[model samples]
Target: MRKRIIIFDDDKDTRTICSLILEGLNFEVITQENCIDILRILDLHTPHVILIDNHLPGMKGAAGIRLVKESPRHKHIPVVFFTGTNNAQALADEAGADFVLPKPVDLARLEEVIELAINS
Candidate 1:
């Protein structure tokens, strides 16, 4: 079965591009505009991985990551931070994210991260 991924980003273009790239790489991608009801979404889909932007609308991506990590049921799912932030790696580490992809996202790196996350 194709691995599933849930992506959250406020930028429509980012969401679209990532979705297309992941879909092309054989992942089942679900895109969300914000982190609202993230737990609900995770529970509903149970995706293998999640990609979140650090600069979301209401809640910051790090905070959203924390929320996911705090949840006992969904905490094991890998969460990756894909953002333009210069300190993306540090932020992701602080937020308990399994990985970080700096934007403008490198397709190769994205693919590698997803594969690593899924296999780890």
Candidate 2:
């Protein structure tokens, strides 16, 4: 089965590239430029995996995760904290993410991570 994924990031280029990479890997990808209204997304659809940016304009990444965790319908969704630096690991921990990966991630690694995330 094809997995559905969601990417929430403020960077346009990052979103575009990641979307392409995931799509190439045979995954269905949805991207959000602004994650301030993630609750609305929960109302629409539930993705198998959610990839969020560490740095955004309005709220912290952890805050986004907390919101997801609070919702029973969406709380079980796996999340990956996408960052541009090694610091992402610490931030991802703070955000309650399942994993942390730097932006412009290695496609092979991403593919492996996706498979693991979906199965786990």
Q: With candidate 1 superimposed using the best TM-score fit, by how many Å does residue 72's alpha carbon deviate from the native?
A: 0.4
Instruction: For model 1, state the Cα shift of residue 58 in Å.
Output: 1.1
Cand. 1 TM to true fold: 0.95
Which regions of candidate 1 fall more than 4 Å away from where they truly are? none
In model 1, what lDDT does residue 100 have?
85
Off by over 4 Å in 2: none
lDDT of 1 by residue, 1-120 (tens): 999999999999888888999999899999888897899999899999999999988889999999999999999999988899888888889989998889988989988999999998
Per-residue lDDT value at 100 in model 2: 74
Q: Give the top-scoring candidate (TM-score).
A: 1
Using Cα atoms with residue i matched to residue i, what is each candidate's TM-score against the true structure? 0.95, 0.88
Q: Residue 1: error of model 2 in Å?
A: 5.0
Each candidate: what lDDT? 0.92, 0.81
Worst 10 residues of 2 by lDDT: 85-94
lDDT of 2 by residue, 1-120 (tens): 888998888888888888998999898999887678887885776799988886777876668877887788887888887778678777777667887777777877777777877887
